[model samples]
Target chain A: MFKDAWLVASKDLRIERRSRVLTNQLLPFTLVILIIFAFTFDTHPNLLVTLSPGLFWVASLFAMTIALQRSFSLEAENQARDGLLLYGLESAGIFLGKVVAIVIQSAIVELFIGFGIVILYAAPLHEVVFLALSAFTATIGISCVGVVFGAMVTGRSRDSLLPLLIFPVVAPVLLSATKAWEDYVRGKVSLGDPWLGLLVVFAIAFGAVGVLTFGSILEE
Target chain B: MKSDRAVQGLGLVAVLAIVATYILGLWITPPAAVMGNLVRLLYIHPPVAWVAYLAYGVTSVASILYLWKRTRDPRWDLIAASSAEIGVVFTALTLLTGSIWGRPTWGVWWTWDARLTTTALLFLLYVGYLALRRATPDVTQRSKRSAVAALIAFIDVPIVHQSVVWWKTLHQSATVFNASLSPKVHGEMAWTLLLGFIAFSLAYVWMLIRRYQIAVLISKRQEILLQGALDERMSTV
Candidate 1:
């Protein structure tokens, strides 16, 4: 099972290496989201304190949702999911592989957009290290759930509906993570701690459930 | 199963429950000192919210059961659909009474308080679930999709429940369930609330049995129609 899981994960990584479509999609999309935020919201330093975290997560989430929703597209579309099933690989292996790849994929975008938000919005990064830690924890939470939600809703004619279904339930993470980000930007170092705790909790809960449920959902 | 009998029984019970709730709520319960006649809205409002949440829970549990066995049991699907429909009705009642209660007490018809906002969003989410099921044509696909959707949507319930603690809002926390109720409220108002809860739970069960039967009838009709169509197509071919 461990070997199969690693192989599945590496398969996705190899596809990305060869095509680079997902990474390509994330870079431009996240950059544009930031640009739109900069142009749209008042970029005053105080406003930055107010909006920085929200802008970062919202952007990262949108870009990452697109990436996550597409996580299974390659396997699902060409009947490759059946191939994977036929390999006698553990279903949980498949879920773990996809989720790990999604986390890695979204992490890249999150790091870029997260730092860029600080630079563009002129947010004080006195706790830049803490902000990154908080954001990373929150990213894992969102990506963990997003992986399952994305696959669960896959194969629908209307693909965009995945986020509509996911965003509301996952909004707490985004909302809390952004709150922590705002506090970190504002130099209220202590305030970010609780939100950080919530983020980690959210990530672990979803990841654990997703792992357990993935096999059942994948069963034919 | 003699479903028609269940429906008839459900209708009878629903009428009786409504009458009982109204009588207990209006005449039996005492008026509030602070809110006056407007406090009567509590009898209807809380029951509706309670039933709505209960219905959503039913749907969530049913969805899990359906997915667990892949039984494609019509009864399970019926329970899910019926509970969701009944839930929507109660949610609407909750919103309407809440708004009415708000007008008299808060001097506004609506407030962006956490509870109110969360309750309103809950209505939208379930309504969307119903619509999603309606839009899909394939029964299997509908079953699978709505099952997942129900599970995902139920996650919002806890957040809605905790919105009071999570955010700063004007909405008061659980009045009946709160720790610090005055003796006056505890003696009289608590009894009224207990009666209200009982009445609503009965109404929910009655409605579920009725709606469950209706759903079964519809699915049965659908199966017959599909069979007839297939037979015609085969004969022509």
Candidate 2:
């Protein structure tokens, strides 16, 4: 079942590779958002330290929302959602595949944004390890909730409302992850301690809930 | 007739309880040493929040039941939808009163503290739930879709509650359950909160039942009208 799910997910990736929609179009928009932010804010070290985490995470989340919403569209538009259902693959497996694709897409966007921040705002390289860990956990937390929500609310108007609804419940993950990153960059080791625990708890809890609930949600 | 009587009785009980809570909270409850009359705001605020959480809980349970039974029962969806709106109201009230209370206590109308921020987010989530309902046209599909949202949304309830403890924020520590309050309960304030809690729960039950009835009647009428249209088309053909 898991292997079949991986095949279904790879099909999505292969399609994206052929089309290059995410690469040619979405990547540029992400770069544009990051560049716009960098020039708009002050370049002072203290101010950059304060703004960096929020800028990176918010930009990455927005970019990922656009990506995930589009990821399911080809299937949904062609009634492939029905076909996927007919394939008898576990809904959780389907969800995990989409989530994996989303995390990778988001990680790419984060790397671009991180590079932009370092270039424009002069972020130190030492904190890249902590930033990577924070980004990895936060991406999983965000994608876990987003995939289910995107599937559930697919055909509704005001589709933009998906992120608004999700960002709040999943906020602690973002808050802790970003805070930890900021603390690491600022060399505040003490404050970063509990934030690691917070991120882990969010990822585990929401991932479990999202996976358990995905099957019920996938039923028409 | 029995259900009607239940609704009427619950309505009266809700009214009486609200009046009792108001009287005790406004006049009988002593002013706080630090916040003076602002402390009274606590009575109205927390119960509204508690009831909001209660409403969301019911919505979640009802949603899962609707999906599990494959009933698409109008009553279940109606209950889920109604409580979501009511939950939004109570959550809004909580945010408003908390802000009003904050101005004097925290010296800011809004601060990005854990509780206040998370409560604000809960408010956003349900507002989106309400909006999603309005957008979808089909009854079964709407219920199904909203049920998914409701279940996903319930996950946030615990997170919202514990956000303050999880992060350093301007919101104060929970006083009632924590060590901050004395072992002896302050009788008048406690009584006021209890009354308010009871009244709010009664109000939710009364309001939900009323909303459910209306939704069932409307949908039934629509179904009948749709069937008639189909019949007319067939006869003409």
Candidate 3:
């Protein structure tokens, strides 16, 4: 299972590297979103700093949507999904592999976005460890969910249905990550806060759910 | 025909009971010591919200049954879809009535309070469920996709609610209904409130039955149309 998962993940990442889609298109798209938020709130530096965490995640979600579309279309556009199924990989492994690929891509993009937030919005980053930890777990939950729904909406209304289906289901991530990061930036980190626990729960719950159901969706 | 009669019967009783509850709620029962007339909505809002939760519960259970190979049935899919449709309507009413109740009470038409935010997300999640079903035109694929979607939404809702509740309690307002009106036990208000629950439950049952029947009819129509199209193609060949 682990071998199969690695095989799939490496295949996806290799495709991403070969095509340069993530860097060439998605990164600039995210940068534009960050700049747009700065333009939206042009007044107080303090307010912009406070709102930075939320604006950053919001932009991430939009970017995540396009990236997800690209991720699934990598399969659907060329019958790659059919080939993968015929390769006898376990569906759970496929799910995990897709999640890993998206997570890695998102992580790199987010690091850049984080810097963009701090620099452009003049946001403070006092609690680096806390912020990084929350973001790691939160991105796992987001990617786990994104991969699941990304596969589900592979066919019909492929453009619009993906985001509408995903954004609502992963809303807890948005709320917790934003609050935890907001607190972290203000140096309000604490031991065993509920937000971190919530993020982990979301990650595991969706991880299990995606594994159990992805086979059915893939067969469909 | 008999089931149709039964649904009509259930709907009539629901309407009559709701009318009685409203009459008792609006005039028969004395107004509360604090909220006065605003308290009457307590009978309306909670019951509608309760039905919303109940409808989603039914949807989740039906989806689970459909997903499980041992219990999979097309009828379960229909039930899941119908209950979700009803759940969306009740969720909408719940938010509307809650907003109406909150405006005069909370000094704002809307607030980012825990329950309100959670319920709003619930509305969006189910609306997405319905949208997902609409996107998938295939029958079996639709069933599988929506069943998974429904269960995922169910699992996420409590986590969403808990996160919001903790966020509010830790820093923001602890609870939205801190000045909540408790139902007086063994009084006319309590009975009317209880009646509100019964009326809405009955209404939900009636709606579910009607929605399920409509779904059955539509499926039958689709099958006939598909057969007709296939026959024409074959005859041409």
Candidate 4:
């Protein structure tokens, strides 16, 4: 399973590396979302700073949707989704693989958005370790569940449908990650643990859901 | 759809029981010491909220049955879908009635209290579930898709339950009528609350069976249509 997961992950990354979609399109889109928030706040640095944790997750989640859509669209074309199953690749592996690819893509966008918030929103990142850990767990939850729903709407209007399907599913990530970061920044570092624990549970729960259900989803 | 006698009986009972609940709630039961007339909304609000949760619970259970290989009957999918459709309605009513209850009690139509926030999120999550159902055209595909989605959306159920416990809440905590087995609310109010629970649960069961019947009929029609299309293409060939 691990070997299959690595193969699938590498295949997606290789395609992404050559196509430059993640770097050229999705990354810029996330940065744009951050800037849009800055403008929406009327360039009030203080308000932006206060609201930055929520704005960051909201923006990253938007970008996560685009990245997921791109990830699945890569499979949708050329009947590649069927091809993945035809290769006798483990369905769980394919699920984990897609999850890894999405996680990396989303995290990069998250990283740039982290930079964008600092430079544009004037929000200080006081605890780097906590922010990154929260992002890591939160993005895992988003990607695993995102992958499930992403593959789901591919037969229809995926671009629009994916967000509606996933935003509500991944809402816990949005809520917990934002709160964890908010507390961390307020210097209540220990208070972040409970939110972090919630994120992990969300991640593990959906992660299991993805692996168990992906086979049947692919068969369909 | 032949109207099942049992279902008809259930519908009559549900209506009569709900009427009893309403009459008792609105007129028979005296107003609270503090809340006065405002307390009447409690009868409908809690029961409606209970049905909403119960509806989702039914959906999740039916989904599990559908997903389980040995027991993967088509009826399970139908039940899951039917329950969720009404579950969304019940959830909407939950929010509406809660909003009405809030205006007099909390002085706001809505607040970001933990319970309210989680409930709102659950409402949207199931709405998305229904949208997902509409998006997929294949029956088997739709079944699998929605099954997975249903289970995922159900993750919030526990959180919503615990939200008040975990966080500071504008929504009232379970004081008299809480999870504890002890009773603080008594007399007509208690009996009416009990009737409301039974009435709503019965109503949910009745609506579920009716909706499932409708869905079965639709799927049957769909199969016939597919057959007709296939027959036409073959005749042309």
Total clashing pairs for each candidate: 0, 0, 0, 0
Q: Return the candidate ranking by lDDT, descending.
A: 4, 3, 2, 1
- Candidate 4, residues A83-168: lDDT per residue as tens digits? 98899999999999999988988888899999998998778899898889989999999999889888788675778788988887
Q: Ten-residue segment with the worst summed lDDT in candidate 3 chain A? A: A182-191
Give me the candidate number with maximum lDDT: 4
Whose TM-score is greatest here?
4
TM-scores of chain B alone in all candidate structures, in the order given: 0.89, 0.91, 0.90, 0.96
Candidate 3 collision pairs: none
Candidate 1 local lDDT, A1-220, one digit each (tens): 6677788888987887678876677688888888888877875646754777777788888887777766777777778877887899887788778877877787788878867866877765678788878878887788777777665654564365666656766777887888887777777787338888899899889888788877756653
Candidate 1 chain B weakest ten by summed lDDT = B176-185
Here the TM-score of candidate 1's chain B is 0.89
Alpha-carbon error at A158 in model 2, in Å?
A: 6.0
Chain B, candidate 4: TM?
0.96
Better of 3 and 4 by TM-score: 4
Which lDDT tens digits does candidate 4 get at residues B1-237?
356887999999999999999999999999999999998887888888889889999999999999888899989999999999999999999899999989988899999988998999999899989988888888888898888889878988788877888889999875344678676678888889889989999999999999999999999999999999999999999
**TM-score of predicted model 4?**
0.94
DockQ score of each predicted structure, in the order shown: 0.18, 0.53, 0.71, 0.74
lDDT of 3 by residue, B138-157 (tens): 99989999998898778645
Among residues 3 or more apart in sequence or in different chains, the pairs in candidate 1 whose N, CA or C atoms overlap within 3 Å are: none
Query: Which candidate's DockQ is highest?
Result: 4
Candidate 4 chain A has its poorest 10 consecutive residues by lDDT at: A36-45
TM-score of candidate 2's A chain against the true A chain: 0.91
